[model samples]
Structure formats: C-alpha cells, structure tokens
Target chain A: MADLPERVEIAEEGPREGFQIEPGPIPTADKVALIDALSATGLRHIQVCSFVNPKLVPGWADAEAVAAGFSPRGGVRYAALWFNENGLKRALAFRDRLSITGSVSLSASDAFSVKNLNRDHAANLDAMRRMTAVHKAAGVPVTRVGVMAAFGCNYQGDILPEQVVRTVADGLAVAQEAGETIADVSLADTMGWATPTRIERGVGAVRERWPHLRIGLHLHDTRGLAVANAHAGLRLGVDRFDSTVGGLGGCPFAGQKGAAGNICTEELVLLCEEMGVRTGVDLDALIEVGRMAERIVGHALPSELLRAGSLDAFRRKQAA
Target chain B: MADLPERVEIAEEGPREGFQIEPGPIPTADKVALIDALSATGLRHIQVCSFVNPKLVPGWADAEAVAAGFSPRGGVRYAALWFNENGLKRALAFRDRLSITGSVSLSASDAFSVKNLNRDHAANLDAMRRMTAVHKAAGVPVTRVGVMAAFGCNYQGDILPEQVVRTVADGLAVAQEAGETIADVSLADTMGWATPTRIERGVGAVRERWPHLRIGLHLHDTRGLAVANAHAGLRLGVDRFDSTVGGLGGCPFAGQKGAAGNICTEELVLLCEEMGVRTGVDLDALIEVGRMAERIVGHALPSELLRAGSLDAFRRKQAA
Candidate 1:
C-alpha cells in the first residue's frame, strides 16, 4: 500500500536467537548444517551463534564450535552475538559481524532488567559503553548495537517513544566517542509488544536522531504482528530485518513459553514478495530449509508459509 | 506506514464458517452460547449460522435451533448464509441478512466450481440468477453476493483481475434484471491465495467498474497474509472484513486442513487498533469469547492474540 523499499536484507537468527531458548541441545554439526542450508538459499547474512555462557543457555554451549565449523559463502556475512568482553573475544575468533546486546529500556522496568540481564539500568549502560569501546578497539568490520525492549517492556506496559530515542542517541554517542563507525543499530522487540504505529514511530524517532545510522528490526511474532510491523518498518525505508527459520526462539527473560518467537524467514520473504518488494531469496529453498530446521528441532514450527505452502501449492492437487 | 481508515467493521462468522468445518458436532446450545458471548463483545454483526443441508455440514445440524436460541442484542445484526430456495426459505423464517454465494472466477476454473458448488461455471451463474430472482420475489432486506476465489483459485493458480471484474458485472446485471438491490459484493479468498498486490489490484478493478457498490473482503489466513491483504484493502478504502473468533473455519471443498481459515477476530482488531484504525469491538471481551469458543470446540485455536494474551499480559506476571 505504501512505497516499498527496492530490496530488504534478511538476517538469519534461528541458530542464535531461536536455538538459545530451546531446552533441548542441538548438536554443533546440526547447527552448522542448518546454517549451511540457509546459506545455500542466498541469505546474505546469518547470525550463526551467540557467545554466551554455556550454563545460562545450554543450547548455545557449542557456539564457538558452530562458528568454527561453518563454511562461509561469498557475499554472506557470518555474525555472532556477544554480551561481554569474553563473549566478544570468543566471537572475534571467527566473526565477520559482531553484535553487542543490551536493552535500552532497562530503566523502564528494573524487574525485567534484573531477571533478563542480572544488572541494573546504570550498570547495563556502563557495560554497553565498555563493550562498545572494546569492539571499537578490536576494529571489527561490522558491529550491531541492539536495543532490546525498544518498543515495549514486558514489565513496563507502554514505553515512551522518547526513551527509545534517548537510548539510541546515548548508544550512538558512546560508539562515536570510541571512534567506532557503527554499521547498524537494531530495535529489538524482545517481548513482542511492537505494533505497526509503534514501529513507525520508533523508527522515525531513531532516524530523526541519527540519520546516518542504518536501522534494523529484530521482531518477534508473539501477537502475530511481526510481519505487519516489519512491513511498517519497510514503509519507513528500513531494509534490514532479523528472522529465524521456522519461527524458532522463545523469550527466556520474559518467561514466555513457546507462543511468541522470531518472525519466520520464509513468511517474511513471502510478505515482501507479495508486496512486490525484492528480497533476493529462494522461497522454495527457504521452505525446505525451514522444514529441515523443524525436523532438527523435533517439533512443528510457527511459520504459516511452511504450513500453507506457496500460492501454487494446490495446483498439482487440483490437476490430479 | 499508510494512512488507515478511521474505522472498520468486523463481521463475525465463527458460527457459520468456523463450525461448518469442525468435524465434531457441537451442541446447539454451545453454538448459541458462543454467539451470545460474541454478541456481548460489541460486535455489531455476527453470521450466526448457515441454512445449508444438515447432512452436508454435520457440525451445523442444529443451525435453525442455534438461530432460534440466540438472544439478539440491540444494534447487532444476526445473519445467515443461504444457497437455494429451500435454504432461503429457512433463512426467511427469521431473516436479517442473506448471502448468495458464487465465485467471480467460476469461468476461469470450472473444477473449483464443480468441486465447491457441485456445478459448472455456466450452471453456477444460472443458479445465481435464479437465486437472485427468488430472493427478489421473497423481498429479502439485505443480500450479499460473494465472489469466491476472487484473487486466486485452488484449481487454477491465479485468477486474472479482468475475470473478477467481468463476473461482478454479470452478477450485478443478473441482480438488476431481477430488480434486487444488492447490499454488498464480497471478494472471498476461499483458499487463502490472495496477496497484497493482488488484493489492491482486484479492489481497484472492482471499484473502477462499480464505484457505488459496497465492497467487502472474505479472507483466509492460510499464508498469513489475510491481515496484510486486509491492510492493502484498507489502503484502497475497503473496510468491511469477515473474521471469525479464534480464526476458526477451514475450507471443506478445497480440501485444506488447519491452514486456510477466517482471519482471527481479536488479531484483526488488534491490528486495526495498532494502526490507529478504530474497531468498536472490545478486545478483552472478544478474546474471552474466543477462549469460550475454543473450549466449546475442544481444541487450541489459531489465534495469536489468544495465545500471546494482551499487551498487558505480563503486568500481573511481573507483579507476582
């Protein structure tokens, strides 16, 4: 309905975001195979793993091995999520893109911050600054500073738009002071509270504050608005999005069960394609990869495209 | 994003479309209770049930009893679906609004017509004309002419926009010849194959042909684009949408299972509310009604809103 972006970049996060909350352990070989299958589908960027504590997230215990085992394809960026200097050091060994994760709305709800990060608001900000400086010194090619709970906090009902702008501004100022050229600043809907209007407003506020910084959306399909919110972002000229295969991942911090997860990769691509936006993805291949992910996960996924198939799915049945 | 309509109307079809496909027979009192619950949620229009053959849709065996049992609330329109003279006569016993169903793309794919209606294209049109003549003689107050598979067909991949326009023209001519003033003409995506661009193009074509006619959309969330396509239609100024509580109903004729169903009522309302579009339906009450429907139907529904709860679902959890 609106003027869509010519093309959008899909960042695969199933291996990292989706797998982190899964109670069952996924073998490193399987993770690598999943990433490889995703790479073959022409996905240009994949967050293959996260460098977090093995005890905290058992699913990501072999993050380093998964990263080391991945066969990088040309033009595809392999990235990892890091929370502290140790995680960053582990990620630096094999990372093309490194992410420093923090929630900008930590101050809005201290209860969530304590449960989610085990740190207070000021401590989280200080850690974010220190992490940004360390990443700058390492001189990684691409660094994404993610502001989780940017749209709404789980403990906090409705986040004020000004708080998001302030967080982005302060984060950008810290990164700039460290002489780091930030590649992207992501707005993470950790609890899936983002609506289209909220997404538009949040994106608008960030763009107004830091017009030069590239913005990305890391959305969850908790209330079935991930794709809709993604569309809203696209209308506002956002081109980069984080999605998980088979709509995997749960919000451990929010104590959410298997209800809400990352936006499904195939579903997002289909949304863009149906809206006449180019995603540079092979839908059929992506669906196949999604099926492989679902099988490996040992359960049915939340993706509609994977379940419904393509528009031509019934052609053969009808012909027969 | 885009400028949304100031307000939109949601027509609840849980009792008719949702129940028709449910294999397990629901008690007449349960269906009545579900409709009564929905009516209390400020939903002004509810398609209570259809007057189709009880043998055809065993789930709707007590349609007339359900209609008789419902306590009609003020400002709510209780409607029924009717196909032929017998069904019309049944509906006429307590008529509010009647639907005359046929696809605009019937000629494009006779296989679908035969499978869905047990009649070919020409025969379906002739039946539609005859039905319209009978409706004129009975002098029903409101009649909705539905064009099933207006965007895409299960039998034939993509139905052209021109075919839809021609069907509407022909259907309108028949109704006019019979001296019956049609209240609404709806584009029904029975197989959930409608896309956003296709929806925009189809709605535009119909508007160009019949500028004065009230256009409505009957969408299925099979590919999860029902909401997106609804948004597209909203952008083109089509406001009336057919939704079911808990996103119930599967297409029995198309042989689809658990994929294509009516757009979930609460989710649609949430989408509209988030986009600054006003829907008078109460979200909390509607979600409760959805849960009641789920309980009576004895299964988990496809509604994300019901699963995710409301935006404030975590407030109590956090407090505890």
Candidate 2:
C-alpha cells in the first residue's frame, strides 16, 4: 500500500451494526437501496451486512441477497461481519467484489461477554482463532478485529486498563499465529462508558503494545459522550471511526429498553469538517440517508443533523 | 436571606427561554402543565415564562396566565423574563410568588443586535438600564441580569472579549446606581460557536474585571459543544447555568430551517453528577418532564434522557 494520507476514515455501519438491533426485519431490497445510497456518499468502507443465524437475528436474514446486489465502486471496500466458520463461509461467497471481515468480541468483563454474545471470554477467543485460520487458508481478507466492551462494561463495571491491554496482545498473537495480518484493531466502549481520560489511556496502551496495528473507535451515545469521545480519539491521532446513519443500533444486552445509539454519521461528519479533518463524506447526502433509515425503522432515529438539516437548509428558508 | 449554600444553580427554561422559539403558538394550558411538571423536579430556579409583546412572539401571549397558574413550593423560585418596561409591568403582576429578571443583548458585531432585537448595541444597553431602574423601584428581587451574545454573534462573526467586559461593567454600574445589588451576571453563547479555550478566556476576563459578581452560563448546542463548554465553565468555578428542559430552544437568527436545539437536561445532569457537582434536580423526574414536553410538542423533543429514559429504565427492562 502506498503511504496512507493522514485522513480520518468514517466507517459507515448502516447495514450490519445498525440493522442488527432493529426489532423487525427490513426487506432485502430496502437494505440494498440503503447500502447503495450510502456507498454513493463517498464512504470508502461500508459494512454491508452480517452473516449471523437468521433465527438469532431476523433483521439480517437476507444478508447474502443484500451482499449480492452491491455494485463495487473504485477505491471502495464492501465488507460483511461474521462470527464462526459457517458465517465465514457465507461471507466468502462475495469474495470477488468484496472484502470479508470477521469479528470476535472480547469484553474486559466476562459477564458482559456471556450475557451479550452467550459465550465466556475463553470460548469466544478460541472460536475467533479457529475462524482466523479458516479465512487465512481461503485467501479472503479479514479486514478488522474488534475488542468490544474494552472500556467499563455495563454488567461488570470499571474494566481495568491492564485487562484491555492484555486482551489486545492475546488477540494479536492469535491472528499472527493463524497467518492473518490484522487490517485494523478497534476498541469499543460497548456501553458508552469510556471518558476522554480513559480513552487516552486505553489508546496509548494499545499503541505502545502493538506499534504496527491501526486503531479505530466504536462508540455508543448512551451517556451522550460519543461525539466528545470520538473527538478525543482524533486528538490522540487515531483516525478511523464506526458510525451508523441516523445513529441507529443498540446493544442486545441493553435489550429493547436501552437508549444507546451509534454515534450519528452526519454529526460525526460535521465534527470532523469543523475540526479540519477530512471525512470524505458530504453532510447533505448523509442527512438524506439518515432520513431514509428513519423511514425504514418506522420511528424517528437519533440523528440531530437530519432533523436540523444543514446550515444551507436554514439559508434557503431565509431566501424563500 | 439566610446564607444559601454555595451551590450551582441551573435554572430550567422550558417555559420561557424555550417556548418563545416555536413558530406556532402552543396552548396556554399545555404551557402551564409543562411548567408545573418542571417545577416538581426540584430545580431551585425556573424561568417560567416571558412577558414579551404578544405581537412579537405569539408563543408567549399567555405569560401572565402561565405565571398565575404556578404555585411555588419550598425552595423553588419561579421567575419570569422581561425585555423592557412593558414586559416588566406584566412580570410585576406576579411579584408575590415570582421573581422578575431582565435581559440585555450586546452584539460583538452591530448587525446581529439590529437583526435580533431591532436595536444597535448602545440602544440595547440603554433599554436594559431603563428596565433596571423600573425593576428596582418596584422592589422586585432581581435574581439575575443576562447579557446575551457574549460569545460570537452569528451575524457579526467574532465578538471581542473587551466588548463583553465593557458590557458587564456597564450593566454592573447601572445596577449599583439603582441601589439594587445584581445577584448574578450571565453570559450567553446564544449561538453555540464557543469552544473551551474561548470559554476559559471569557470567564477569566470577566472574573478579573469583576471578581465579586456571581457569574453564570447560558449555552446553546448549535455545534454539539454545549456540555463541553459548560464543563469548562464549571472548571472555572461557575456555579449557575441556564438550560431548557429536553433542550427545547434554538436561535431564530440561526434561521428557521436548520437550527439545533438546546443541550438536553439529561446529558447535563449526567455530566454534572459524574463530576460530583450538585444540580439539586431529580434526574428521574426531569426525564418524565422531558417526555411530557415531547408529547405536548406533537413530536419528540431533543432530550437524550427522554429517549434513553433513565438508568432506572434500563434496570427495569433487565429485571423484566
């Protein structure tokens, strides 16, 4: 790869992460249209869908159909999230036009891992390692590995920095042994509990331990600190972020009652642009996508930019 | 008055500061119920309604009726905001149970003042002084004198710190001549263009100029930095804040089309509680009030706590 410019990549998550938490199934055609619209907004990396069991999460039941309909554009990467080897096989079917990615969540707290993913810490790590080996042999790129709940877990509360550092080292070691070079390593504030001070410490520790690994952030707006936390990460020189259009998606462990949404795409873009960081996404286009997502969900989504529109919207109203 | 605890007083603005922004008029009964609900949340100060010309702001046409409906309880001080002598006369009718407060807005740029208040900077200051004299002779306890647009005005662009300082000195000098001690001086970021560095500079300059005058903050969330700016003010030892419940208000100058709402009450409460500052407001009750406000508005309000409900809401869901 040529020297990557110092640009912040906003990894759009409307398909996999945003859809998973939705109560009812969104049709495959609508999902395709949503992804197609989002891709046209110049988002370089888009997580199209996840390869989980249809019975477990009905929202992504048509993941394969949705993936098949995606038209790859230049310099853009379409990816799907998978759990075990079966899911990995399903994702590998789109290898010609897309990059297949696998995720294993390691919670700093065991209770959260078991409660959320229905697996303890050791079992989850072991499954991830096996999947890594299968993907390596198939020559499909495993673009990312994320450590969810690396900050304080909702169930366990106050996850130590030492635990997160140890988990990153263990996951990196497993991936290396399987001959899979990790494209990116992300730390998620699974419950939106990480502060700027904690983020600085966590990101710093990860960088010191694995100098070659790229770091990204996956944040929730549970405490309304997601944007501030993302800005803090940027200040520390970490570029990539995971956001859902209209700030859709919530934790399953948090269940139906949880108010936490993904950090909003339009708001994130506005923040980046104001700070002089290049996100390569248009605010107006993202707002249009956000409104569509709101319609699909049958409820108003949590994005402020969509409701407020843009400064141009205000200017136009004045002109009228 | 007995020595009040050196506590930070955040006055809720759902009724007055918030309501005036709505383009269409909300029902008087709904307005009364909203204030009644907010009053029950244990906020020490609540700006209940504004006594502005009904022609200028149709939403506040029933200010006197709204004030009459409010029955003050222990420690809660219901207040009404007045812009000039006629508004103060309307405010004085509720003097038995409500405190009357006055506002003067200075534009760092002269154009904003003309556009927003229909006067230049000097004329606005003159109007404020005249209102102060009328307020003093009536023996109404003036809890606060607010200076709006203390930060940069949207029309003028950047406001000089020296302009802010001079405005404060002038307001203070008038209050002294009237023989009524100004309880506190509030600086508002009417547009949410303020950064932490600017906040620190503004606060530091104001403190150095008038060390004994109590200072407060009234911030907007136009750029998603209201909470961060509030935190900066708190770090500078500012104890009072003016916020609307559910973050209901926006600047008319931000224009009608794309204005952002005020900072949500739940987010502010969470930030303050986490920092160990006492806001003396009940979080659960405040969330309930936010929901009520949403119902009244016929659409969802911008409150984060209302959508997320409370931590208690999550705990209950987990229990189920």
Candidate 3:
C-alpha cells in the first residue's frame, strides 16, 4: 500500500449539524464539555455551534454562550454555521475569535424545503446571497458554503445530478460577487437516501465543474449505505467529511429513529488507516469520547466501534 | 425489466442449521411451531431437525420427537440433518415420511471444526463416507451433502476453494459407491466471512469443476455482506439457498453473541423481487412469519424489512 498523507484534516460537525437536529435540548455546560473534549482530539476544524434562532431550534438555544465560552487550542480552527443575515450577525459576534461559515439547504423536493425550512429553494438562495454580502462588508470570511439534499430527497424519488451542478454554480457566482473566499463546497445526503452510484455521479459532476473547489460530503446512514457511499466519495478524491460523534444527527422530517449513527468516526478512521490514508485522529481516544457523549446524552450512542473496539485491540486481547 | 422466474425453490434451514449453534436451547414447542409456520410459507424444502448427539448439541435433544410430531404437508419435503453413521440411523426413522440430508463440515480450519463439531476435517469426512454407505445399503436417497466453510473461516482466515471442490468430489464418490444419489452439493459460509468477490471465485470454482452437481449457498450475515454475496452466487448460476427466517442463526464457536441475523429473509426477497429474480415468496406474508418467529423467540428479530416494511407498502403509505 502507498504511504498515507502526513496530516488529514477532519472537520467536526457534532455541535452544529448534529445537535441542531436532536429533539430535546441539551444543557449548555454539557455541550461545552463535549466540544472541549472533541477539540483536544487533534481535529483541525470543529463546527462548534449554529446561530439559528432558539425558538426555531431549541436544541441549540445556548449557541451564543457556547461560542463565547469555547477554549480554542493553538492549532484548532473553530467555526459556526449561519443561515441568513440575522444568524450571520449572531455568528459575527465570535468572528474575532473563530472562523464563521454559511450554509443553505437546496432540496430537490420543494415540499421538503417549504415544510422543513419554511422556504423554497429560490428564497433560500436569495437569503444566502444577502448574508454573504453582509459578511464581506464586515470583513469576516465566509469559510465554507454547503448545498444540502444534493442526493435524492425523501419526498422526491431521484434527484438529477445536473440540478446539484447548477445549484453549486449559482452559489459560486454569488460568493464571487460578495468578494468572499469560497473555502469549501459540500454536498449532503440530507435524507440518507443516496446510493453509491448516486454519490459517485453527483460528486463526479461537482468535481468536473469545480476542479479547484475543496469538496466535502455529509451523509446519513438511514439505509446502511453511508459508509459505502463515503468510500465511493473518497475514491473520487473527495477527502473532507462531516461526521457527528456517535451518529447524533437525524432528519426530523423523516421520523426514523436510530437510523444508524453517522458512519461512526472510529469505523471511518479504521477504514482510512487500513487503506493507508492518514486521519490524524486516535481510534481509542475517539471511542472514549463516544462513550462520554453517550453518558452525557443519557442514552447509548449509536457508535459500533465503541462496542467492537479496533481489530488490532481485539487481536491484542486475544494474545494476552 | 425481465420477468421473474416461476416456482422458486428455497431450502428452509431454521431447525438444523439455525438452532445448531444457538447458545440456549429453544423450546421444542417453539421449534415445532417455527417449522410448521415455515412449511406453510410455500417452502418446498425444509431441513426440520438434526440427528446429532444430544450431548454434543443439547439444543437438538428433542429433535426426534419434534420431527415425529410435525404435521406432514403434501408438497413440502421435510428433511433431517445427519452427521455420521449414528446420526444416519436416527435420520432413517423419519426417512419414509421425509427426505434425509446429511452434512459434513469440510472446513480447512481444524480449530473451527473442533470448536463447532468436536472433530477434525479428516475425521468428519471419514464419518460422512461411512454414513453414505449405510444410506446406500437401505436404498435411501441422500437429499443434500454440504461443504461447510467453503469460502472462509472465522478461526482460520481463508479456506482454499480447491479444498471445497475436492471435498465435494470425495463426498460424491462416496455417495456413488453406496448407490445413493447426491441430490445437491452446497457451499456454506458457516462463519459468515465471505465477500462478494470471494463468493464469485469459490462458487465459480465449484461450478466449473462439477457442472453436473446441483449447487446451493448457505450464508450468514455476520459482516452485513451476506445478501451481496448471495447475489454474486445467483449471478454465478447457483440457485438453491439456505436462509433462516429473520436471519435467526449464529455459530456458537464464533464468539460473537447475536451477530446480525442471517441476511434477513424479507430483505433478500425484496432484493430478488427488485432484480427480477423469482423467489416465489410473498414479501408481506414472509414479514408476518418473521414477526411470528420473533414472538416465539421472545425477542425482536433482525429483519430490516419487518421494521421498514416493503417498498410497495411504503409507496402505498406515501400515496395514502
């Protein structure tokens, strides 16, 4: 096997993308401790909180407090997620201390968007453009912009790859006008309905059009194909991924509970390690963090590696 | 899409292969009910019980009584599993009413053989040869003889495909000498460690060497690749399969408790249906049987289709 890269950058999504979709509200201190422990794990980027309204998403009610209290390490780059101008204003409060990123949901099904986000695709794009302009004027960098639901939607059967390419093109045009550096472009399987073929086609289309764009994939394991899809993406030269520790996130609209945890970070790391891809994260330490998260959440987290441990660890136990 | 083939023939393995490795003894009444329900599901071939020693496998202590008391169905061919000359005698008691199938563990792994059946490979083959001689003397036909651990073993990583082919050849020679017809030769992944590529290679090897032999596949879903491997086998022209309802079987020696149920029957049927391969199994009815088995077992079974329902059913709910 070829040697792995020296350092692979993994962006943590547990705080923003993970916690925002969780049903009940988790305490601010507990969330802070979770983030703190995660920060110490050698992760280059950690999306600590989202600036959405507390009334809209009660799970992230402590977003501002959590953002302010985070103890940033020397090498860690903390980031926050924002939706529109108002959320961007809230996110800018921590701009001097941490990086800020913007995101928008681009649903293949208009019904899902109107029902879940209360806005259609065009309206969401318009809001993103205005937010980008405001961030540019304030001299805060819009590090990343993501397009969610690039794969098939729950309400709609198959999402065309062309639609995703067009959406990414439109987002790029908007980012250009705002004079913002488009740090990364991400495609999300928001409903966990993506197959490996669909991921390959969609990511391939984006890579073909935007060769220089740093691509990331956010997937859900609703159909037990998340890891397979992630592997497919990795083969296509897309490295950065968004994973919740212990598979914490779910689509509130889909209504399937415990839909397999976010591809299990330990499992992904193991796969990468076996394939000679450097992740720069310790498997044992990540498993410990998963267990800690399970205790804090008052429920068993859906991570398989925590229970199974690493294969090497298993072999070591047998030898002993 | 091409139309599905008519009259699908499946070999039900709940009684012998399913419960053989179960840690705790399942009640005879429950076992009897499971067989009756399985018979009612239009399965033409059912391996109802095994004639191994009760001391070796206490789970099959009531095998004779259960086999004797089972209500005979006209078209369904009930069979008993026999391991040696002693087991053949026990199987002969039910020979007039049902077909008798004998099995020999032809694994390359001595450790797995000792752990599973308390015999080495050479000893098991010798026992099978002697058993075949007895069946020939009685003018009874041996319905099936299987080569276990054909692809890979949990105890010993990779088993040579040639070893499997040679074992089948030896078993066939013994049956020919005894004047007993070898109705089918099965390749079993008793430890559930075979991948799709391995399935193609192993099954392809068997088919190429013995084109006249009726081939079968017995798979376990220990690593979530059972269905994919089964698909590979189907593509390789091996039709007969051994699947327990709700994938309810595990190897006692494998050391993992409650490994994911056999490649879930409902999931298998759904895949076959979508792929235009005829299994002649009702998806909805199979789900009902799976639920019944789950109830008898006093625990939820590991069938994804039972929880998710059929795709047609889901589409109906969406329309409703």
Model 3 CA deviation exceeding 4 Å by range: A1-49, A64-80, A89-99, A134-151, A158-187, A196-217, A228-241, A254-261, A269-293, A298-309, A317-320, B1-82, B85-99, B131-247, B269-285
Better of 1 and 2 by TM-score: 1
For candidate 2 chain B, which ten residues in a row score worst on lDDT? B1-10
What residue pairs clash in candidate 3, if any at all?
A247-A262, B247-B262
TM-score to true structure, per model: 0.92, 0.84, 0.76
Per-candidate clashes come to 0, 0, 2
Candidate of highest TM-score: 1
What is the Cα-based lDDT of residue B314 in candidate 3?
40
Report per-candidate DockQ. Answer: 0.51, 0.22, 0.16
Decoy 3 TM-score against native: 0.76
Q: Decide which is better by DockQ, 1 or 2.
A: 1
Per residue, candidate 3 scores C-alpha lDDT tens digits across B230-285 of 66566566677878777776645345554554556666566566445778777777
* Stretches > 4 Å off in candidate 1: A95-115, A253-255, A312-320, B96-111, B253-255, B312-320
lDDT of 2 at A316: 50
Chain B only, TM-score of each candidate = 0.92, 0.90, 0.88
In model 2, the Cα lDDT at residue B231 comes to 65
Q: Give the number of the best model, judged by lDDT.
A: 1
- True-vs-predicted CA distance for residue A49, candidate 3, Å: 4.2
